[model samples]
Structures are given as structure tokens and as C-alpha cells.
Target: MRKTTFLIPILVIAAVIGLSSMFIVDERERALVLQFGRVVAVKEEPGLAFKIPLIQEVVRYDDRILSIDVQPLEVTPLDDRRLVVDAFSRYRITDVEQFRQAVGVGGIRTAEDRLDSILRAETREVLGSVSSKDILSSDRAALMLRIRNAAIAQARALGVEVIDVRLKATDLPTQNLEATFDRMRAEREREATDERARGNEAAQRVRAQADRTVVELVSDAKREAEIIRGEADAERNMIFAEAYGADPEFFEFYRSLTAYGRAIQGGNSSMVLSPDSDFFNYLKSPNGAGQ
Candidate 1:
């Protein structure tokens, strides 16, 4: 019975030691075996792993890509324009052994903090070399690529690989926003003023041309009317000369009658003359002789 009791205790202790020594590493995880706070072995593949019982412990880290959001920071471009930039990064622990050695017991959190600093410094350096227009434009993809490349060099020391760096938002600072809007408004107003001035100049030119055309048309019509009046007067004088040559006495009597009609037109004219005056010849005789 005593031997049976001793065997039971031995088996129980062995089982406990076995359970504590064995560990599992999932496909999504990488583990480090630490002895007295120092890493003794690294298990990168997913499977069963073993370590000394009561002397070592297992520390696991995510094997998948991780993300870190950098706090928004201000960057000044070469143009001296300041912008607020929010960014994020993707990274993966490439060397588990190196990662543990660099960050010690702090693990992923410590690595992330160090990575954030590298990213911030690289972002400022790359973005500051360009103009604000480039940072805010579609070319920002190229700028982001530069940041990732620069960060990759520094992140290797922390045993992490920088996959990508991207700007989430780029904006003018609150104080600069109003100033930028005012400048834009002023530019638009200047363009409008130029357009209006051009329109007014064109209108003035058209109006002057119209006035000149009107004067030319009126002067042409006046010259044509004067020519027609002079030709009509010449024709009337020619007709009178031919009539006088055809009949002397009749022409003389017609002249006298025309004179009398003019002197007494409207039957309200008054005149005093001798009875035997030559002006009465046509009234006294049809032949215009005072017989």
C-alpha cells in the first residue's frame, strides 16, 4: 500500500512537470523561451515546443502584420507652407530573436513606440523636401513610398519590417485655412475684373464702329439727294427756254400772267400803278400789245 502511494505521487509530479514544460505555438504566433528573463530559444513555426520546467517561460508575439496610427503632426514644406498630417504604418516582426533582444520584456508595445518615432522622422524629412502642393496632390503616393523606404532602413534595427506608410489626411492648419481662402477669393475677383474690362473695351470699339457707319450712310444719302435736285432744276429751265422760242407773243403773255398771279396771290395783295403801265399789257389784249 505504501509503494502504491509513492507511485501515485511520483506520477502526479511527473505529469505536472510534463504539462508545464510543453507549449503550443499557433500558426498566427511566434514564441520565445526565456530562462531567467533571457531568451534561450525561439519557436517560429507553428507546432509543439519544449523548455525546462520551473526555470523557463514562453513569450508569444503575433506573427501577422500589425498597424500603428501615428498621432497627427505638423510638417513644413520647402515652400514654407505648414500642414497637419495624420499617418499610419504597416509592419511585421521579421526577426523574433532580434525583436526580443532589442525591446527586452516590453515586447510589441515597445517595438511599436520605436517604430512610430522612425516613421515620424522619415515623414518629416521626405515631405519637407517637397512643396505643399505635392503633398496634397495625387503624387503623394510617391512621397509615401519614399517615407516607407526611408523608414525601412531604420526599422531593421528594431527587428521589424516596414511594409508601407500612408497619409490618412493632409490639411492646412486652422489658422492658415482662412488665409488661404481669402487669397483664393482675391484671385477669382481679379480674373473677373479683367474679363469685365475686356468686355467693356470690346463694346466701346463696336459702338465707335457703328457710329462711323451711321455717319457715312447719312452723308451718302445727302449727296445723292442734292444731285437729283440740281438735275431737276436744269430740266425745268430747258423746258421754259424751248417754249419761249416757239411763240414770242404767247410767251410774253404767259410771263405777264405769271407776274400778276405772284403779285396778287390769295386775293389779299394790294398794289398802286398807272392804268397804261406795261404790266397791264396781257390784261388789255391777248397778244400782250396795248391796243
Candidate 2:
């Protein structure tokens, strides 16, 4: 019984040692076999890898593309326009051995910090030459390409390959945008006020012209009416003169008859004229021939 218990403990320890000596390198991972804190071998191929138990350790790194989103930064363009920029980079560890040597035990965290600094530097250097209009336009693609290329060159020291660097957002500063909107509104209001003033001036001119036309029309009508009345009165007077000249005696008789009718127009009228007066001659003679 004592021998069997001792053998069981021995087998368990051996099993643990065998498992510790072997490590896995997955398809997505790269491993560095370290002996006493010194890197000895790089296992990049997928499958089982070996390291001396208790003396060697395995450090694994991701082989897939890594992404980092940097903080929003403020940049001044060549035109002096200020913009807030948000950016990111896509990269991967191309040489695990170099990455291990450069980054040491810090791993991905250290790599990302270095990459962020490089990306920001490259972005500023490239974008500083461009105007905000270009940054916001289709030319932004070319600008991003330039940044990616520059960042790649600098980040190569870290054994990382930059696939792309892109600007996620480029926008006017909040205070700047608010000020611009206020200026635009003020300009529009000024234009509107100018237009209204011009319209009112035109309307005043038109109204004055209409009032003058009305006055001229009224004066012309009154002048024409007075001319026609004078002509009619002159014609009537000429006809009366001609009738009087044609027969002087009959005209005098008619005048006397008109006077007699005026004197006796009232029913209770009393006249003291003699019966042989010329006023009664019309009533006395059948023909209006006075005595």
C-alpha cells in the first residue's frame, strides 16, 4: 500500500512537468520561448512548441491586425483654420522577434503607446500643410495616405507594420462654429434689411408717380369741361342775337309778353297799368303788333 501511494504521487508530478514543458502556438498567436528571462526561440507556426520545464517560459503575442483609436486633437491648418480631429490606426506586429526585443515585457500596451505618438506626429506634419477645405474634401484620402506612409516609416522601429491611418472626424471647434453661425445670421439680417429698404424706396417712388398722374388727370378733365361750357353759352347767345335781328317788332312783342307773364304770375296780383299800355298790347291784338 505504501509503494502504490508513493508511485501515484510520482506519476502526478511527472504529468505536471510534461505539461509545463510543452506550449501551444495557435494560428492567431506567435510565441517567444524565453529561458531565464532571455528570449531563446520564436515559434510562429501553429501547433505544439517545446521549452525546458521550470527554466523556460512562453510569451505569446497576437498576430492579427490591431486597431487603436487615439484621442481627439486640435490642429491648425495652413489657412489658419482650427479643427478638432479624431483618428485611428490599423497595424500588426510583423516581426515578433523584433517586437519582443523592442517592447520587452511591456507587450501590446507599450506598442500601442508608441504607435499613438507616431501617428499623432505624422498626422500633424501632413495635415499642417493642407487647408481645412482640403481636409474636409475628397483630397482627404490623399492626406490620410501621406500620414499612413510617414507613420509606417517611423513605427518600423517598433517592428510594427502600419496598414492604414485614417481620420475618423474633422470638424470645426465648437466655439468657432457657434461664432460662424452668428456671423452668418448677422449677414443675412443685414441683407434682408437692405432689401426691405430698397423695396420701400421703390414703393415710395411708384406711389408719388401715381398721385401726380391722378392730379394731372383731374386738372385736364376740369379744363376740358369749362371749355365746352363756354362754347355752348356763346352759341346760345349768338342764336338769340340772330333771332332778334330777323324781326325787331316781334322780338319786342315777345319781350313784352314775357314781362306780362312775370307780373301776373301770382293769382292775387294787382297791377295799376293803363288798359292802353304796351304791356297789354299782346292780349289786345291777335297779331303781336303793338299800338
Candidate 3:
């Protein structure tokens, strides 16, 4: 019974040690065997891995692509326009051994922190070199590629491969938003003012042309009327001269009658003249002679 008890305890201890010496690494993970916090072996392939019991430890890191959301930061573009930018990145640990050495016990958390810094710095550098219009435009695709490339170069030291970098949202700062809107409104107003001014100028030109046309038309009408009036007066004088040449007595009688009609038009008219006066010649004789 005593020997059986001793064997049971020994078997239990051996089983515990055996379990501690072996670890199963999934296909999505890479394992690092560390001795006293020093990486002694790198297990990249998925399967069973071995480590010294209680003397060495294993650290597993994801072999799959990882993602990080970088904090939003402000950047000033070439035009001195400031914008707030939110970004993210896809990355992977290409070298587990190097990653282990670079990050130590902090593991994926530390690597991500470093990667975030790289993305931010590269983002600022790439975005700062261009105008805000480019960042906000479709050309952003090219700019994102540039950022990824720059990040890939810098992230090498962290044993990470930057697969892609992208800007989520690029916008004006909250305080600057109102100011930008005001500027836009002002620009629109200025354009409207300019258009209105041009319209008014065109209207003035049209009005002046119309006024000139009216003045020219009125002057022409007045000149035509004066010409017609002078022609009519000449025709009447010629008719009178013909009548006088055709019959002297009849023309004198007509002239005397026209004068009498003018001198006694209304019933209240009064006139006093000599009885044998030439004015009474038409009344005394039908032939305008004092017969």
C-alpha cells in the first residue's frame, strides 16, 4: 500500500512535467521558446513544440494578419490647412524570433504600440507633403500607398510587415469647421455679387442703348413732321397764287370773305368801319367792286 501511494504521487508529478514540456501551436500562431526571458527557439510551423519543463517557457504570437486602429491626429498640409485624420493598418509578424526579441514580455501589445507610432509618423509625413485637396480627393489612394510603403520601411525594425495603411476619415477640426464654412459662404457670396454686378452692368448698357434709340426715333419723327408741314404750306400758297392768276375779282372776293369770317366768328363780336371802306366792298358788290 505504501509503495502504491508513492508510485501514484510520482506518476502525477511526471504527468505534470510531461504536459509542461510540450505545447500545441495552432496554424494561426507562432511559438517562441524562451529561457530566462531570452528567446532560444522559434517554432513557426503549426504542430507540437517542446520546451524544458519549468526551465523554459513558450510564448505564442498570432501568425495571421493583424490590425491596429491608430489614434486620430492633426496634420498640416502644404497649403497650411490643418486637418484631423483617423487611420488604420494591417500588419503581420513575419519573423517571430525578431518580434520576440523586439517586444519581449509585452508581446503583441507592445508591437502594436510601436506599429501605431510608425503609421502615425508616416501618415503625417506623407500627408504633410501634399495639399488638403489631394488628401480629400480620389488621389488619396496613391497617398495611402505611399503611407504604407513608408510604414513598411520603418516597421522592419519591429519585425513587422505593414500590409496596408488607410485613412478612415480626414476632416477639418471642430473649431476650424465653422471657419471653413464661413469662408465658403463668403466665396459664394462674392461670386453672387460679381454675377449680379455683371447683370446690372449689362442691364445698364441695354437701358442706355434703348434710351438712345428712343431719342433718335423721336428726333427723326419731329424732323419728318416739320418737312411735311413745310411742304403742305408751300402747296397751299401755290394753289392760292393759281387762283389769283385765273380770276382777279373772284380771288379778291374770296380773300375779303375769309377776312370777314375771321373778324366776325362769334355772335358777340363788334366792329366799326367806314361804309365805303374796302372792307365793305364784298357786301356792297358781289364782284368786290363798289358798283
Candidate 4:
């Protein structure tokens, strides 16, 4: 009975020791073997890994991609406009050995601080050299690329591979929004006023042109009427002169008759003349013989 009891205890101790000496590392995890708190081996591949029980320890880390949420902060752009940026980063551990040396027992928390600082500094450097409009435009992608590249170069010492840098949201600071809106409104109003003034000036020009056309038409009409009247007078004088040349006595008599009619043209008219007046010659003799 004593031998059986001692054998059972030995078997149980062996089982415990064997279980502690070996560890199964999942594909999603990386194991770092340490002896006396000093790194001895880094197991990046998956499967069973062996370690001396009670003397060696295995620290596991996530090998999968990780994400860090950056706190929102303000950045001033080249245009002197300030914006609040909410961004995040995706990263993964590429060099576990170096990670251990840099972080020591501090682990992922210590590495995060350094990585975030690099990302933020690079973002600020890129954003500061560009105008606010550029940051808001499609060129933002290029700026983000610059930030990621710069961050990747700086994060090499941290044993991390920065996969991408992304901005979730960007906005004008609350304090500046009202001023920007007011300026925009003022600019729109100025443009509207200018458009109206230009329209009015154009209308005035059109009206002046129309008035000048009307004046030219009236002046031309008056001039044409005067020309017609002068031509008619000349033709009438020529006709009368031709008639007088064909028959002088008859023309003289006719002219005397026309003078007499004109002298009495008014509805109420009277004239007193000598009874021996030459005007009476036509009345005294039809042949106009008594001159």
C-alpha cells in the first residue's frame, strides 16, 4: 500500500511538470520564452513550444493586426484655420525580439505611447504645410499617405509595422465656425450686389441705345420731309415758268386772278382800292387791253 501511494503522487507531479514544460501557441499569437526575466527565444510560428518548468516563462502577444484609437486634437493648417481631427491607426508587431528589448516588462502599453506620438507628429507636420481647403479636398488622401510613410519610418525602432493611418472625421473648431460662416455670407452678398449693379448698367446702356435710335429716326424723317418739300417747290416753279413762257399775257392774267383770290382767301376779308387800279383792268376788259 505504501508503494502504490508513493507512485500515485509521483505520477501526478510528473503530469503537472510535463504540462508546464510545453505550451501550445495559437496561430493568432506569438510567444516569447524568458529565463530569469530575460528573453531567451521568440516563437512567432504557431504550434507546441517547449520550456523548462518553474525556470522558464512564455509571454504571449497578439500577432494579428491591432488598432489604436487616437484622441481628437486640433491642428492648424497653412491657411491659419484650425480643425479638430479624430483619427486611428492600424499596426502589427513585425519584430518581436526588438519589441521585447524596447518595451521590457512594460508590454504593449509602453509601445503604444511611442507609436501614437510618432503618428501625431507626422500628421501635424503634413497638415501644417497645407491649407484648410486642401485638407478638406481630395488631396487629403495624398497627405495621409505622407503621414503614414513618415510614421512608418519613425516607428521602425518600436518594432512595429504601421499599416495605415486614417482620419475618421475632421471639422472646423466650434469657435471658428461662426466667423467662417459670416464671412461666407458677406462674400455672397457682395457678389450678388455686384451682379445687380452690372445688370442695371447693362440695362441703362440698352435704353440709351434705343433712345438714340428713336432720335435718329425722327431727325431722318424730318430731313426727308424738308427735301421732298424743296423738290416740290422747285418743280412747281418750273411748271409755272414754262406755262408763262408759252403764253405771257394769259399767265399775267392768271397770276392777277391768283393774287386777287389770295387777297380774299379769309372767310371774313375786305379790301379798298382805287377804281382806276390796275387790278380793275382784268375786270374792265377780258382781253387785258386796258393796261
- Candidate 3, TM-score vs. the true structure? 0.87
TM-score of each: 0.82, 0.72, 0.87, 0.75
lDDT of 4 by residue, 1-291 (tens): 999999999999999999999999999989899999898998988899999999999998889999998778789998888999888999999888888888888889998988888888888888999898988887688888888899997788978999989988889889999998999999999999999999999999999999999999999999999999999999999999999999998999899899888887867788899998998778878565545
- On TM-score, the candidate that comes out on top is 3
Clashing pairs in 1: none
Off by over 4 Å in 3: 216-220, 267-291
Per-residue lDDT of candidate 1, residues 44-130 (tens digit)? 989999999989999999999999998788999999999999999999999998999899989888998899888899999999999
Candidate 1: what lDDT? 0.92
lDDT of 4: 0.90
In candidate 3 the C-alpha lDDT for residue 260 amounts to: 88
Worst 10 residues of 3 by lDDT: 282-291
Per-residue lDDT, model 2, residue 164, is: 91
Write out the backbone clash pairs for model 2: none
Residue range 14-103, candidate 3, lDDT tens digits: 999999999999999988888998889988888888899989988888989998999999999999999999999999999888887788
Ranking by TM-score: 3, 1, 4, 2
Error of 3 at 200 (Å): 2.3
Which has the greatest lDDT?
Answer: 1
